[model samples]
Target: MTAGSSPRAVVRRYADVTGHAPVMPEWGLGFWQCKLRYWNQRQVEDVVEGFRRRGIPLDVVVVDFFHWPHMGDYRFEDEFWPDPEGMCERLHAQGVKVMVSVWPQVALSSENYDLMRQNNLLIHAEKGEDIAMMCWEPCTFVDVTNPDARRFVWDLCKRNYADKGVDAFWLDEAEPEYGTYDFDNYRYYAGPNVEVGNIYPLEYNKGFYEGQLEAGREGRIVNLTRCAWAGSQRYGALVWSGDVGSSFQDLKAQITCAIHMGMAGIPWFTTDMGGFHDGDIEDPQFKELFIRWSQFSCFLPVMRNHGNRSLSHPHADDPSLAALDAPHERLLKEEGEFKEVVRAQDGSPRFYSGADNEPWSMGKEVEAILVKYITIRNKMRPYLRELFDQAHKDGDPIVRGLFYEFPQDHRAARLSDEYMFGPDILVAPVVQAGARSREVYLPGGEETIWENLSDGQIYHGGAWQTVEAPLDVIPLFARQGKDQGLRKAIQEASA
Candidate 1:
């Protein structure tokens, strides 16, 4: 391997060390809708119904964390999600895929915690009071390094979810994120956490991927994980930037994050669209930030929206109120008659629900912008399918930095805000707050011509241009002489 090698060569070297990237499922090519949660079965159905009523394109709908009775039970709480099978059936009927969140932390009171602890299948504390993580309460991470542990958790998921028609999983907490970064204080079946912690996410994804494969499920396996290591891509890990804030700066970081993730060999990537924290749906500034983020999401490998949008009235500090609205209250109740309700440092419930995060939940102006970009994402599915094919066959990135395509253009190597969405299109997202236009550097190579999707204006490569970007548009340019069909699709969507 050579230092400062071409991006293709670097990616190829990565594939040589790891394996080729997994094939992407066709359903994954379209837009996915997610929030902090869809708490109840009715809430899930209503959101899907709202999308259909509004005629917005939705391919996947996620049931985020706390749907289960306990963090480790792997089954829906009957009080809230009374009809898991029927809910899946309804979403499937609408041609939508269902992905439920699965965390790796097993609370002390979890149904299987004793069994795992007795069998040495949970992460151990080297010096503490035997607790490995503290979320709502004391919990331990599953020792994914142990084969038995992986099978144990996977069996629970397969029995509780896969049998119920759930299509995929959102593997949250893949990082096995600890309350503290006390890496030296933990131990795993394979080794001490300090020596093996980095591989935790790899094995986390592996558990589900191997389980799905063993269950006779075939064709591309797509599991959304919060973090990943080098070989995680081969396990079908669609890694996402975790729990980021809802700010313009955070949105800007996501662009570089995805581009670098692709460069690092994880081709499947997404973000918490609009960001995950402190987004007030009613706030004008937040709404503006969301529109810009949503437009940027349209060009990524996976276009999924997620976040904890803030409410007009703050209720997180009120324990009674948070318990009333919390998704995992049943677990709290089960753990010693509500005595185990995990309170934050401030005496509030550890979990807090956000304002409604559906596309229509936002105001009309934001809703229309989201709907337009979503429509554009749907139209680009054909082009995305081709990109996925190339990814599977050649380990190429669907979402790549300009340097990947224009490795010889020294200027393109340093450009982070602009990226090439496959080889045919260059995407320049509006990353700053209150900015209506931005400068874009078109990578120059082989006498290339770039076409602006918004105005059909043509510009030669190897130059920079200040492009106009209003609330509704982020700058999108298609390569002039290649993939004419894709160019037409961009034209129709932009028009």
Candidate 2:
């Protein structure tokens, strides 16, 4: 319970107690393209090519979960990802970095499972069948709580992934997302799950952070993680809201969550810019939701687009998937068309990939809007870099609630729908479906002037103004005499 004269001051004091987030790499500040799964090497490359071909600025492309032969393989399946080093090199040549998904689950069939079990490097089930989760297979988590276990996993990752030119990792399922939240059944090197479960994510991130540092990588390391704890920011963890449903309500919830996460001392926060589940590419409603979400995401610490689209099935009988036939037969023989445990002979789950979630996949109109916001995000890179610096040095949030910048204004404290992007820009996102115009409060006295970024109008602070928000526009105002470059970016985006 630290208090200061202002919210920023309180944040600084809180950060001093919990530790500040790492200075994010410039690439991490740019737009990241991802989906539920980029199933193979060609698909990942194709998506990057698609972005480049359209002149969209993409900084990172993620290889989501189940790219390997099995859970806990810590390496890509050669059958699917034949030339890891070459693929990374090609992506690097195109100026896009690769982030591979890594889950904590180690299935019973994993090559290293026996070794890990012998060394007690896997999380132990104190009772029952020793399986921690049963999503695709009966599996146990690597005991990231133990120093030795952390080192063991990191060593495999360094040898297999780093050596193959992977730039960063998507540390998925960091909460060790159990099949059931049966905390008492699990035990870690640190303690029983009920006693020490909260620390799991922190240690999960710490292992990679420390391992990267030991390998002589500095300053540029950032890992996308699903969960985080008190000091996870110090370990270069960029936390995103996990597995969120696609809805207007979820979008509204993200605003509050971002503010709360920053106040909790984790300055780096992002959400899947179109939500993670049930967003259909062809549906007009989803397109509207995605457009609004993309606008909001442009102001976030990291701008990312990801989701699993409805009716976009990977096994839709396309000839391109012909290579998967033999594997599918083997999987069916093993699991008998029970899609839940769709595994390869090597025990890796052959999960179905979602529909194409690229910006262009969402029809031309939505594509244009998404590209516009992505361009705006690209132009704000300098401003974002500074915000990240402040977060690293002084623990300021990149996405600030109205109260964070205007502590004395009681009305500002109550505005959750609108927020500040750093100290300069005030963003009032269109949160409701089919709402064309909404009221915005420009806090501060008459001396404070606000420049309406949308139509280049002017307003005095401490006044409520109704702003028109078409499908293409988000209400933006740059604080007069502050971040003039932000206004320039907005102009450039429109241009």
Candidate 3:
């Protein structure tokens, strides 16, 4: 298993056996913006406009889940999203890429459900009711394992989304997250879910990856999926830890996830910046947690800001959005055998949209902190792009454990809290709540020197140093003399 070598050597060997990541597109490297559900065309446009007005560097804006008439409609709901093409064109004109969400669940009431069901494109329940998930309604997962089924879905996506200037797809439910985990109950065209379920996400991404290639797209395919299998990296699957809660505990867990996911060969990774489940935007404790997490997110391979933030108010002046703060009563009209599309009182498709999560949505102090980190991320794009190129060329990870670089240092081998962002930048994220400073272990003995990126203070390796980590500063150190210009840029940005 490739023993008796450095960690980097072992990872390179692993890449030789499996595969290397594709070169990521330039836009995919910068900051991405998203919330729970940007349900309408107008809301999506407004977020882009907000970023433009504030001059925040935004690479991609995600229109997350339930923009469709139904789960399997594969097209935007006409009533809510009046002009998908024009909206995408407008975003592209602003230099922002659009990522639309697509789920595998085919509801019984969806317009294409009958066609899919008759064509045997849906997953089958061997002995019970054929429903695979009941998350929003009774629905079955698409058997993406089948080539015909893969082509069937990708064709719809190409016509409805890709053709409309949408730049990428968020393959949510790549796990086909079922309402229940009875793996044996379901079967796919490939095999029984329990036996071959691991391949589901691989094929799930392969469908779109192959489709994009067929459409003549080259070196620019990025599918942000929730789950991934072995070799999924080859398909340009940027995996994110899914549906986590908002807590300091959850924040600590992401560091481990990123490091291990990179080790496991998924080079591209991200997380919901403020956690996905519940983050109260106005809570002082949450704002602190969010600031800390946003700092951690700055060094990830893809720096994306997303969450389902709990809000006290809608923040918009529209009276229709007043219902957003209220309980989602699931106002629905029956179709035939199943409950139909989730709707609001005004007969529009309704999914609970969280509070404003824009860079400027938080209070002035938090907003200033966010803006600073975003500026730093934009400035580091060249460095990040080089790291991504390494990943593509050698199967090396963008986020790596200290042991990968300083294997001889016993303390660095034991440390889990700090990691290397490529070979140059060292990131020690503040994972605890209300903590100002933390001890950082700089590896590589006297031969290595680290420059404090924020203030240009210097420190030698193979020692533990307690750094001053204020609210605005994320403890970052540049290795040796590698990023002098970047160091100056960071100091100026902080200044």
Residues 193-214 of candidate 1 have per-residue lDDT tens digits of 9899899999999999999999
> Relative to the unseen true structure, what is the Cα RMSD of model 2?
3.5
For model 3, name the residue pairs that clash: none
Q: Which portions of model 3 miss their true places by more than 4 Å?
A: 1-4, 313-349
Which segments of candidate 1 are over 4 A away from where they belong? Answer: 1-5, 313-351, 483-495
User: Residue 252's C-alpha lDDT in candidate 1?
Assistant: 87
Q: In model 2, which range of ten residues has the least summed lDDT?
A: 330-339
Predicted candidate 3 versus true structure: per-residue lDDT over 1-495, tens digit per residue: 654478888888887777778889999888999987676789889989988998888999999988887889898888888899999999999999999889999999999999999998989998978888886678988899999999999999999999999999999999988888899998899889899999999999999999999998879999999999988999999999999999989998898899998888889999999898667777889899889999999889988989877655434664545453345432222221111124555754566566678877789889888888888888888888889999999888999999888888888877878899998889999988878999998999887999887777899988899998988878899886887367766676777
What order do you get sorting by TM-score, best first?
Answer: 3, 2, 1
Candidate 2 lDDT? 0.87
Give the TM-score comparing model 3 with the true structure, all chains together.
0.93
Q: 1 or 3, which is superior by TM-score?
A: 3
How would you encode candidate 2's per-residue C-alpha lDDT over 220-325 as one tens digit per residue? 7898899999889999999999989999999999999898889888999999988997787767899999999999999899998888765433345654445445
Error of 3 at 39 (Å): 1.4
